[model samples]
Target: MAIFTENIGKVSVGKAVTWDRDAALLYALSIGAGRPDATEGIDYTTESSFGIQQKVFPTFAVVLGGSGGSMDHLGDFKLHQILHGGQSLVLHCELPPQGSVTPRSYMSAVYDQGKNAIIELTTELADPEGQLVATSVTSMVIRGETGYGPRPERAGSWAEPGSEPDAVIEQATSVDQALLYRLNGDRNPLHSDPVMASKAGFPRPVLHGLCTYGMAALALVRNSTLLAERGLGSINARFAAPVFPGQVLETRIWNTAAGALFQVLADGKIVLDRGVATAAAAVAQDAAELQDAAAN
Candidate 1:
């Protein structure tokens, strides 16, 4: 069956979600934080470290506030035919080590792209008190779903900065990176099963796009003291290609007046592009504040 465009604007019921210190720490390590050198990012990795207080990475909100939109309503389609096209996230405040929130997802839009259809979902997560914690917008491309109309065009383009990047941080994904990242809630076999990957036209299982996204976010925080102190107000990126596990990911960042423009490259090929990281208000410069985001 084809994507049900009629499902657009559908709203999902609120679903409660919670996470604790262990979940946060696991997310950090899955993205290769504090690896090889345990001392580098003790704040995110070790909860009971002498005097350091563990803090959650701002990107952790993505896992918590996933598109609660139900795919079953979108009509029948094979999972392997879908691709993670893009993602955008906005955080309202610093995530505590442990917290609970109810998330509701909306089927916002469905666009025809000639041979494929793009389905966008928007999710809002709020605390028990009804204060918004995070908002996430995710887009998925369904392959071979054709004949709706011409593709819609985004307004702007991502131009490579003329000057050199302000910062470049490289992180290596282990051979088991996908295996570990799957534990974070995404269990799509495309990242685990070779047979399923073949059905998706991949030589082998590829890394989760969101995993690479989270890695890029953490890299930015570790490379910039300003970002670490201020925290990230928002992050947006478009997936340009698939990144296989065991490959090295290099995040190139150009600091902008608004925040920063970034891209993630693997083996010299840009895998994530049109990236933007919005910096939150700067907090007081203190030891405690520094430790809170030491390894974001």
Candidate 2:
């Protein structure tokens, strides 16, 4: 199948979507936040004042991508073959405990690799008063689903580190990470039912896509030196394999001028690769403004 050149510049902006406390809480739970032994504190899972102020789990931004858009319309490709390659989010400010938000999203770029395709999409979330809340970018890699034809002008592949990664972080998924994540409203039984999962070619229930997403986020937060210095501005990655619960994920980090390159590996195999996270420059600007205010 060939891509629709006419849809190259396609864009879609959606109405403001209000998120209540329930929604926020539910999203947190979806990423295994409430689990008894998860690294995140138990306050997030309980009803308390401190829980209300807890940082929103970063992976919750995935829900914001859906308003109205057809993947088929954008590319002459099979939706079934489309896999979420990677995702990244930057929080402009602390999200309010509860509030409404409007999200604007669009396809920023598409690269054809002859045998595969890379699609990049961006989404912006704003509050009712028109303040920007968060910005997210997602990259999808369609394997064996690329459009047939001549190759475009060549651009070099992003550089990967030649030396051993500077750091490695590992985490194991709970047996119920998928079941727990489904409470957030994604009812895909592939993560819940053993029979369904087997039918889908898994020996057991699989983890939720967002759970894998959260694991990736944890990798970024725990291992990146740049994020600690300036905060995460964005992340881009490609998902390469399905992760079953109870698998130990080892995330490796590589430093670069443009961003930090990372990968998520399971069972000694690379499951999520070509991962990148960029830090926010505005954090320094905001700090400077605060310093000036304090001096005044």
Candidate 3:
């Protein structure tokens, strides 16, 4: 069976998740908040600053408010043929340091691209007060499952950014990075189960794409040169390759008329490509912010 385009608008509720500060801190560290003895972002990765202030990384919304629904309603396709294509996040406001959020999601679009089917899922995350926290849009490519779903009625709704990056941020991924990242919510065996990894045709477990996304966004925000201008408005990327633990990630970005274009690489390999990040639109900030961001 191919992707069930008929179910495009069907909606569902994901299991609610009660988030806390400890978990938030763990998430911060997993994304390279406080690593290599860097004190710049200790506020995110450590609790020492909790006495003064409680902060949450904006990107945490992806996991904290992640849609926990099953996509079985779509169609039957081999799991091995599924690939994470891209992810984008839109934040309405900063999330609280700790709170419970339930994600309501729907299948937005299904595209038949000759050799594979593309599934687009959108999830809205709301706090207990029903206030929107963030929205996550994820696309998955289903191989060998094609010619059944209808082409998108809208054209050019989803397009890749331009070539070349204007800014590049490099960070090292720890060998145990995946171990800590999985604790954020996704306990998927594919990221930790050696047997499952091998069966999936990998020598070992692979890092989660979301983790790479967090790193990419944070990299841009952490860049002194970039932070000197504005904050991150939205982040988007396509998972181009698998990133093994202990790899150095280089997030290359280009300032665009629309926002920012980007791509990620590991050991000279393109891992996440066709990236885009919209700026917060000229947020006032002095050069001092750059000094602070560079501490990390």
- Using lDDT, give the best candidate's number: 1
TM-score of each: 0.86, 0.76, 0.85
Tell me the lDDT of model 1 at 130.
89
Off by over 4 Å in 3: 50-52, 148-164, 224-229, 281-296
Candidate 1 lDDT tens digits, 1-296: 78877877777866689998999999988988877677887788779989899988788889985668458887688876887899988787788899999988887778787679888888888999988888898988889887667645652235678899999988899999999999989998989999999987899999999999999998877765556667787888999999999999999998865467899999999999999877775212222466788867
Residue 277 Cα positional deviation in candidate 1, in Å, after optimal superposition: 0.7
The digit string of per-residue lDDT tens for model 2 on 158-193 reads 467799998897777777777767876678787788
Q: Least accurate stretch of 10 residues (summed lDDT) in model 1?
A: 281-290
Clash count list over all predictions = 0, 6, 2
Candidate 1 regions exceeding 4 Å error are: 75-78, 146-159, 282-296
Ranking by TM-score: 1, 3, 2
Model 1 global lDDT (CA atoms, 0 to 1): 0.83
Question: Which stretch of 10 consecutive residues in model 2 shows the poorest summed lDDT?
Answer: 148-157
Mind sharing the TM-score for model 2? 0.76
lDDT ranking, best first = 1, 3, 2
Please state the error at residue 200 of candidate 1 in Å. Answer: 2.7
Model 2 residue runs over 4 Å out of place are 32-52, 143-158, 255-259, 282-296
Candidate 3 pairs with clashing backbones: 166-253, 166-254
